[model samples]
Target: MRVAVFSFPGWGHLRPLLPLVRELLDRGHEVSVVVAERFAAAAADTGARVLTYPSRFPAPVPEVRTAEDLAQVVVAYYEEAFAALPAAWAAFADDPPDLVVEDALSTAASGLVADRAGCPVVRAFPGFAGNDEVPLNGSEPEPGSPDLDAEHPAIAAFVRGLPDRLARLGVGEDAVARVRARPPRANLVFVPAAFQPRVECFDGSFAFVGPQPPADPPPTGWSPPADGSPVVLVSLGTSSNDNPGFFLACGEAFAGTGWRVVMTTAGHLDGATAAAMPPEVELHAWLDHHAVLPHAAVVVCQAGAGSLMDAFGHGVPVVVVPQQPDARVMARHVAALGLGRCLEGPVSGADVRDAVLAVAADAGVAAAVAALRSAIGSAGGAARAADVVERVAAATPTDGGSQSAWR
Candidate 1:
């Protein structure tokens, strides 16, 4: 089978899909990854043919201080991505593949391609799967917030113009509905079923495939400090690393403490700023959390789905300082599952330190983390994802009736 995997530009979105793509290739199937130009090299390393597309607008890096700001950021992202879809579609049209696997968030482009090419589309959720029963993030939006109002001017305009946009691409009116619906014919979620919101409500259409582990462990020269202090790993993921103040707060929180802090600044912190960090805190521009996480007693992070799953995979409890809506949702799920604590709204250094210490000291938290790890192991990460992809590929219609494929 020839599998075409489409992902948004960010690491959080693309990384989860790599393991499954590589697995398909190892099984002797042809795989090609369509991604933003910035990530083509990483995708190519999976041994899949790489197709790159230009992202016209810079990926948004918002300081999500309020719900409204987050809403605007989401809207702006969709606007920018939707603008680039026509060109992205044209690139895929030249060599359509047997099946389409796409990041769940890349609906604008993927929906059209599936419709035009009449191929089965499998949506991969790098984070939580959205449904009517559960909020997209873990919680409901603020009342009257643009995030909840589909009729908000920006989203409304996008929806209103969507038909004409599809028409221009030679897609039928039925494709408009697929573009709006959240689930695809089949969906793959990277988290274990225990972590999913409203898991009981989901039907057979969703597969809880657990965390996709790295195909090959990242090489790292650093290890736990040999001084016998417990390690705390701090990261804000790739796009949200602009928060220097948060990183500094983490440094201060652990300063003079027995815990050793290892922070990945993702190169967002300047040399002088990083040099000024507390002596007890070690800073790296980037480190494979997979290599470093097993040594950590606790992870203080932005609670992105990938980071949360990675931390849990290693049985390291987390202290979440969420920076966005999805992160907030994942943090809530973490707290609810007894996996860790969620710190919301203007968290200080003391808050960060206390949450880590509290969760670390809780024996029940440790037990819950262990249980989740076992569940994740049984959830069948990459192999299960490949199985679902193969099944969907076999079921796709060759005729132009794929607009109703999800049904």
Candidate 2:
């Protein structure tokens, strides 16, 4: 079978799908990954055809301060997807893919492409999966809250522009709308079912097959301190690491303590700032999370899905500082599940220290983390995700729709 996988720009988005790509290739299926030029090498490394598109969706996207700014960022991402569609069509116009797998965050663009190709699609959620009870993309305003798009004009414009984008792709709005109205043949979520919010609300249409570890993970040149002090790993993910304040706070929080701190700056810190950080805090431009996670007693980070999964997969608790809406949702779940503590309002060295110490000592949090780790291991990761894709592909008719495999 021939499969086409569509991805969003960030590494956080593309990384989770690589294991599935490798799995398909190993199973003797032809695979093509649609990605921006920036991510071509990573996709190509999987031994699949790399379809490149011109995307101005900047990596380390500029920090968004308001809903309007965030809406504009959303518009930019959709526009990037719009640019990718023509290239995808040009490649498969005559002989299309048997199946299409797309990032759940990118469903609109990729689903429209699948509609034009007459192929079945499988949506992969690297983060939360939403339903009637809790919506993912967007939903009506809550109670007396204002309508999102109405209050945010850019979002309103984005909603209005959808039809035109479909028209340009030679796909009717109804065809794309139909794809959205019904769930895909399979929904692959790269997190354990235990981690999901309102897990009972999601039906068999979703498969919560936890994250895949990297095929060739970077070498861990890191080692624990000879003094045997506890280690704390601090990060703010790739895109949002521009906040020097958070890193500075972490440095102060662990200074003169028995806990040693390891931080990945992602090139966000200047020489002066790096020099200013206390000696107890070690800084690196980049480090394989695998290098630090096993030795880590606790993880302090901005609540990103990938980071959270890595921490939980290692059975280490976390202290989360959320930077966005989706992250906030993840933080809430972390707190509710007893997996970690969520920090709110203005953060300080004392606050970071307190939260990390609290979670690290809490026996309940450790037990919860251990149980989630077990659940993630049992969730089957990439192998099960591949099984779902193959089943969906085999069951789906040539018209690119299926009802038999709703898993």
Model 2 misplaced stretches (Cα beyond 4 Å): 58-74, 137-146, 150-169, 172-174, 213-218, 396-407
Please provide, for model 2 over 210-274, each residue's C-alpha lDDT reduced to its tens digit, 9 standing for 90 to 100: 98743333577788898998999999998878888789878987888878999998998998888
Model 2 TM: 0.89
Each model's TM-score?
A: 0.88, 0.89
Worst 10 residues of 1 by lDDT: 398-407
For TM-score, the strongest prediction is: 2
- Candidates' C-alpha lDDT: 0.79, 0.82
